[model samples]
Target chain A: MNFPSKLIEDAVTEISRLPGIGKKTAVRLALHLLKQNEVVTEALALAITRMREEIKYCQTCHNISDDLTCSICKSHRRDRSIICVVEDIRDVLAIENTNQYQGLYHVLGGVISPIQGIGPEELKIESLITRVNKGEVSEIILALSATMEGDTTSFYLSRRLKDSGIKVSSIARGIPVGGELEFTDEVTLGRSILTRINYG
Target chain B: MNFPSKLIEDAVTEISRLPGIGKKTAVRLALHLLKQNEVVTEALALAITRMREEIKYCQTCHNISDDLTCSICKSHRRDRSIICVVEDIRDVLAIENTNQYQGLYHVLGGVISPIQGIGPEELKIESLITRVNKGEVSEIILALSATMEGDTTSFYLSRRLKDSGIKVSSIARGIPVGGELEFTDEVTLGRSILTRINYG
Candidate 1:
């Protein structure tokens, strides 16, 4: 579309470069910014730039942090002996939202994916191994997705850590709490039955 | 959600302020930006900031512009005698995308919504009158939406422009071209029957 102003066109062009944003959505967002107060735009722009420029990752866990070590990894109350390994910072946030876990996280940055040319070396696997070598951690939980890449990463990590004698576990997969068995997929259904827990 | 970093929380807070973006999507987008190279975020932030700070509007039509008059209003190829009145700059972009119209446009900025405390005085109705008083225009099209506010604005403008001797018309309303008859709503179907046209 021919924009009446180059600034709007340029803004839309840049915004559409992000994941899942199309030209139309970018246009809508850019125009919304135009309708808002300058302070709003200023704050948004500043926040984005500051995040990209000044944001740091935890040296210990590779989670998003403004300091050398993330808050979760540094907190004495958190269970340092159990590390939950996940794909990225968003997964850490998701797990944190459940309020079900109080352990430190090891952000692998991404999982093993041959399709995208990403492998174990592309992730922070070496750092994870280094943490495990310290021997303070007793158990490591693989909290990655159920996708092929997630499974591949879990397998590789388990094999590598087998010699180290640390227990490696994965999050259980079953029907979601509110889901019906009739609607559950075959693989999950089969696994749910095979991994059934003993009744109390 | 507990963010590992304050900067991440701040960024998510600001990004989620846009329309339709919630806290979850904002966190996803913020993390996506973090995963990408710094230049991506830099470009996005720069484009938004530059657009908001340096944008200009057309003096003649009140549309977005980089200079005094917009390109369309200044173009000799477009029909200056015809003006298509619209709600805002997005409408101008939408109509332009059709590649069907070759007329000038006057942006009213907004519709008459008493509930929202917006009225004729709050919009560019006076400026539209001023444009018509120049005596250069012969036809004015009411290319606004088909809502109550749009109809009220059109009626008010027509009443005010009765003495100008300029032809005024609105775009046709009926079932959308590819719309199914069974799914068409009552108002549109009723209007289609009432405004039946002759076919040779």
Candidate 2:
């Protein structure tokens, strides 16, 4: 589209570079910023640039943090003996929001997806094994997704840790809390039945 | 949702403030940016901030521009005698893309909407009238939307320009080029029939 100003065109092009945002949405967003207070755009630009420039990855867990080590790994309240493994930092945030898990987390950065050209070596699997070899951890929980890649990564990790003497476990698979039995998929329903626990 | 880093949280907050973006999408976008090269984020931030800080509105047409007068208003190739009035700069781009309209544009910024607390005084109506009184323009095309607010604005402008001796017209409304008659709304269908022209 022909833009009246080069500045607007450049802004729209940059905005549409973001995932899931197309040119139409980009134009709309640029126009919205134009109509808003200059301070809003200034603050947004400052926040994004500062985040990209100053943010660091935790040297231990590989999770995004302001410092060298993330708060979770540094906290004494967290159980250092048990570590939960997940695909990325978002999963860490999700598990943290639940307030149920009190253990330290190891963010794998991504799963082993051959289709996407992501192998086990590309992830932080080596660092995780190094953490486990420190011998302080007693339990390793595989909290990856239910996808094929997640299962493959969990299986790979289990085999690698088989020699270490640490107990390996996985999060349970079942229908969601509010899900109806009739609406549940066949594979999930079957797994839910197979893994049924005794009522208290 | 809980964020691993405070910088990520701030960035997400600013991104989600944009129109049509929610917290979840904001998180996804922030993560995507984090995964990309730092140069991408820097360029995006710089483009947005520079656009906001340096862009100017056309003094003659009120359209967003880099100079005091817009390229369209300054161009000699465009038919200066005919002015097409639009609600915003996007409409000017749309019309220009069609390669059908060659007249100059007068962007009103927005239409009159009492519900939105937008009145004619808030728009560039006075400047438009001043341009019309310059005795150069012979016709004014009301190229606003089909909404009630658009119609109200067009009616208001036509009444204001009644004594100026300029011929005022509106864009033709009917079924879209690829629209099916069976799926057409009754109001538009009835109006199309009422305004039917002789067959070519």
Candidate 3:
């Protein structure tokens, strides 16, 4: 479609480049921005650019932080000996939201996906191994997803860290809290049965 | 949700202020931007701010434009004698996309709606009358939607322009092409029957 202004078209093109946003939504969003107060656009632009330009990953866990070490790693309340390995910062946020896990996080940045040409070398796997070898950790909880890539990363981590003398464990495979038995995937259901605990 | 970094949280807060985005989606978008190259963020920021700060609207039609007079109004190929009245720039785009209408447009900006405290004075109604009085040689097409506000605005315009001696006509109402007989709204169906034209 022919836009009346080049700026509108350029704004739409830039916005549509974002993940999950399409050309039509981009147009709508750009027009919406136009109708809004100028300060709103300014705030959005400033926030995004500031975050992208100044944001840094934690030196210890690779999670997003303003400083070299993340807040989680610095917090005295968190269990430094137990590191819950995760794929990225989103997962860190998700696990933190649970409020059940008191352990610190180890963000891999991403999983090993050969299809996307991403391997262990591309991720923070070497740093993770170093963190393990430095040896203050008692247990490592593999909190990655159950996807093929997640599983591959988990397997690789387990093998490399086997001789480190630290106990490594995967998160439990079980039906979700409110999920129906029939709706549960076969692998999770079957594994839940094999690892079933005595009724309390 | 508690974000690990202040920058992340601030970015999410700003982004979620958008019309349809939520806090969760905002966080996701923020993280996605963080993972991407710095240039992407810079470009997005520049585009949005530039569009907001520099964009201009046409003096004649009030449609968004890069100049004082929009391309549509300045086009020599378009019919200068006829002007189509529309609610906003989007309507101009929709009509232009049809490629059937060759006339220029007069954007009312919005229709009359007392419920929202918007009236003829709140809109560009006076300018439209002024344009008509300035010797528009022929027809003025009321291309507003068929809602109450649209009708109210159309009625007001017709009464206001009646003394100018220019022909004022609304767009025709009929069953939409490829629409099923059983699923049509009663008002539209009744109007279609009352305004039926001969079929081949």
Best by DockQ: 1
Query: Tens-digit lDDT track for model 3 on B72-136?
Result: 98899999999999998888888888889998899998999999999889999888878877885
Q: Per-residue lDDT for B27-49 in model 2, tens only?
A: 89998888888899999998999
Worst 10 residues of 2 chain A by lDDT: A88-97
Worst 10 residues of 2 chain B by lDDT: B1-10
Tens digit per residue, CA lDDT, model 2, A89-124 = 889888988999999999998999999999999999
DockQ, structure candidate 2:
0.78
Query: Looking at candidate 2, what is the lDDT of residue B162?
Result: 99
Over A30-148, each residue of candidate 3 has an lDDT whose tens digit, in order, gives 98999999999999999999999988889999899989998989999998899999998999999889889999889998899999999889988888888888888999999999889
lDDT of 3 at A83: 90
Candidate 1, residue B135: how far the Cα is off, in Å = 1.4
Q: Between prediction 1 and prediction 2, which has the larger lDDT?
A: 2
| Model 3, position B102: C-alpha lDDT score | 94
Clash pairs (backbone) in predicted model 1: none
Every candidate's DockQ is 0.86, 0.78, 0.84
lDDT of each: 0.92, 0.93, 0.91
Error at B94, model 3, angstroms: 1.9
Q: How accurate is candidate 1 locally (lDDT)?
A: 0.92
Stretches > 4 Å off in candidate 3: none
